[model samples]
Target: MLLRTERQPSAKRSSGRDTTEKPTRGADVMGKGSVLIFEQDKIVRDVVSSTLARAGLEVHPAAELDAALQAFESGKLDAVILGAASAGDGASELIHAASRVSLEVIVLSSSPTIEEAVAFVKAGASDYLAHPARSPELLGRIERILERRRAREDLRSTRQENLKRHGVASLIGSSPAMQRVLNLVDCITDNHDATVLILGESGTGKDLIAKMIHWSGPRAEGPYMNVTCTTLRDTLLESELFGHERGAFTDAKTQKKGLVELADGGTLFLDEIGDMSLAIQSRLLRFLEERAFRRVGGQADLRVNVRVIAATNRNLEEMVARGEFREDLYFRLNVIPIVMPPLRSRKGDVPLLVRHFMNVFHRELHKPVLEIEPALMGQLEAYNWPGNVRELRNLVERAMVLSTTEVLWSVVRRRSRPEAPSEASFRLPPGGVDFDVLEKDLLSQALEAARGHQARAGELLGLNRDQVRYRMLKYGLNSPAPARGGLALRV
Candidate 1:
């Protein structure tokens, strides 16, 4: 009975029903919702209440603003329909009160002009409906508003869940070393603009640590951009960092913004920072000091708010001592230094890491690997992982991808080591041997263990291939051994 009943025009009584429109059922217009009606006119109030009740909504009718506010507070009202004629001077006040509690307010007017309707909307009215409106129009508007509110709530919940998964829980380790790292991260997670320096060897998950800090901080909603300093040349890297004006150079056809500008109010991660040239280091230092930078070929200085997180596997102290890295930049970037321990140092957490990766790849590959062979697991834990967590993850993925068995047993094994003798089984020579000779012997033994592959040999010795090659050249081992993949190893 939403539409007005049409029989004949009544000159004596006002029914507040539209005679031209046909009656429509409220149930077909919208779903059930809670509504509060505030109106002083008896006929108008009854009409609205009846329409809403027939529409399957929980309806509450109030004669004055005070009673309306009481009902609004008592019931879980999704919306409020106020008659401006009866609301009179307190119409705006009622609208504001409903808004404070996040309740949607709709205003009904007898003769609302365009400006009056606009004013009501500006005063926090969700919608303004003129008198003599159809019941379907009112119910549809309320349905749409409730639908949008539900959508926003659902989206917010999804974002919070994602933040929890990637921000803190992704670190994943119970070892003492990992616990210390987590404690450090937790302390500074709220400091959005603090510079964080992550120190670790390659593949030690420095990038992961940087992400954890950024995503857990206040700037989590902002942009995050990661750049590898060593991957770009000096000139290109400069333009990429500080942007460039149009006609600045041969390739500068149009003005471009840099990572700093793009990452405003968020974080900019500079990986392999030890490889950055001295010139870029000077520019970076100025930005850190002043929070401003001039684009290439541009005279204007642009200011930006950004958090700088730097990571590197190289030894910065040694580079500073050699005058290759700026000492001032080193101290500035190291405001909060977090050291990521290599995987070999935390052997006790190997099994946990293994299971974590197994679950990850199993989901990705859609394959079930429910168990691990004890022998293979023992070998994995015993091996000294040079590439750290990255290497271990790759090893697990490799085994899972290639094996067809329900239980994983195949493993990538490193060269076997000769058994070490007990302390009592060996006697020191009368004249102690030179430390250099022993070091050289160990280097040669590692080379033999790797079967003359410099890369694998370096992994065994905890050094890179370049360092191993330099050592071989110094020891006068010039004969090249046969190797695959264009690798020439000194025999």
Candidate 2:
């Protein structure tokens, strides 16, 4: 639960040119990072943890530095905060223990004078926080430490991936949805010859799955070809998939190799395979049925060594029923179907995804790591991702670029869901003349349902964001009753 300050000091607004916001979650830092408040004073730990949580960090508090160390090891922390003088007599040993376990250390003092802060920094503390705390600076320090961790891991990963390793293992979270995906990838690893079709909506990371299969497979050393069916014309696609002989078409002035030939001894990924025409599907089916294909405008048949991995956002079964797709070809490609879950379906992955995007944006823009406010994370989990993982990725990337210091709650809140059933289809009762009366009724109904959450309640009503605000003014609804030392949102 969020512990708000009693007798709260109105948070002083900063006048700096840059508007720093609350933090958002960043990349995988290996272990669960927890802040251990070792101050024996209950009030001290409360204040520290409360401050940390307010800044949007995961805090794990212990009264003793020794106990904090134990918890650190037990919880597998990426970093640990040893509250000032809280370690008692074993503070030095505690610091060493932290480094030994590869934990980044931050030493915090309630009354850290200049000398104390310097000494602690010199003594292997990645950060030294002087106790009369400044939320922004402390947040900045934590962000820096996390970024360093990401750079180190990313460097290690780059080296491994250069050797053809599947690297999405760095993506964290023990969500069952993620585990199922990993399991499916494992199943596809041993079946290089078996045709695999990855089915998912856009942004569901079908491309990643295809690459993971290729990189993890026995054919990791071979070429990997990617062809997007939607991006190519039918004639061009045929020439692209199969080699073209000289004078085959106006653009084909000379003999040219196709994706299949280029991908010889490797993996060929056909994205948007459902977009392939029936004629092209027939050719592909023949190749899949008997690993042989003739070049465009050529009489000779050629056999090539390659593994085909097809991905599509379209429902091929529906297309087959409609005669837009060949059922025979669909049967040939469905040898090993791997269906990806949309982001909305995997509630456990939201935190991991937040961190993933955080790390990504922090590096891309060279910004500090930001902690994700719990409130924001909850909002993310509650929202349905109709566009799938791709949609989530885009939102995150945009947030990273546009976000200031805090998680971009405005963007999250501003995001509009797909339109509901059209109002045009629903006729009002006879004599629907009073517009204000109609609006007041709809607004009252929604507000009652959401209990004064303007955003959510607005979604329940078939109205754009502006319309909701305008109607709220038209009705007698307001913000939640204010609580002392908490959010004083405008009604």
Please, what is the TM-score per model?
Answer: 0.67, 0.53
Q: Can you give the lDDT of residue 319 in candidate 1?
A: 92
Determine which window of 10 residues in candidate 1 has minimal summed lDDT.
482-491
How do the residues 381-425 of candidate 2 rate in per-residue lDDT, one tens digit apiece? 877765555556666777667665343565456554455578745
CA error at residue 339 for candidate 2, angstroms: 0.5
Q: Where does candidate 2 have its weakest 10-residue lDDT segment?
A: 481-490
lDDT of each: 0.79, 0.72
* Index of the highest-lDDT prediction: 1
Q: Write the per-residue lDDT of candidate 1 for residues 1-491, one digit (tens) a residue.
A: 12222223344554787544333544554556778889999998998887778767788899988898787667477788988788888888888889887788888888767777778888888788777456777777777767776676675685576577667788878899999999999999998878999999887889888888877888776778889897789999999999999999999999999998898988899998988999999999999999999999899999988999999987899999999999999999999999999888898889999899889989999778657778777877887777688877877787678754322333333335544678644344666566555556667777877888887788777776646765776565554433322212233
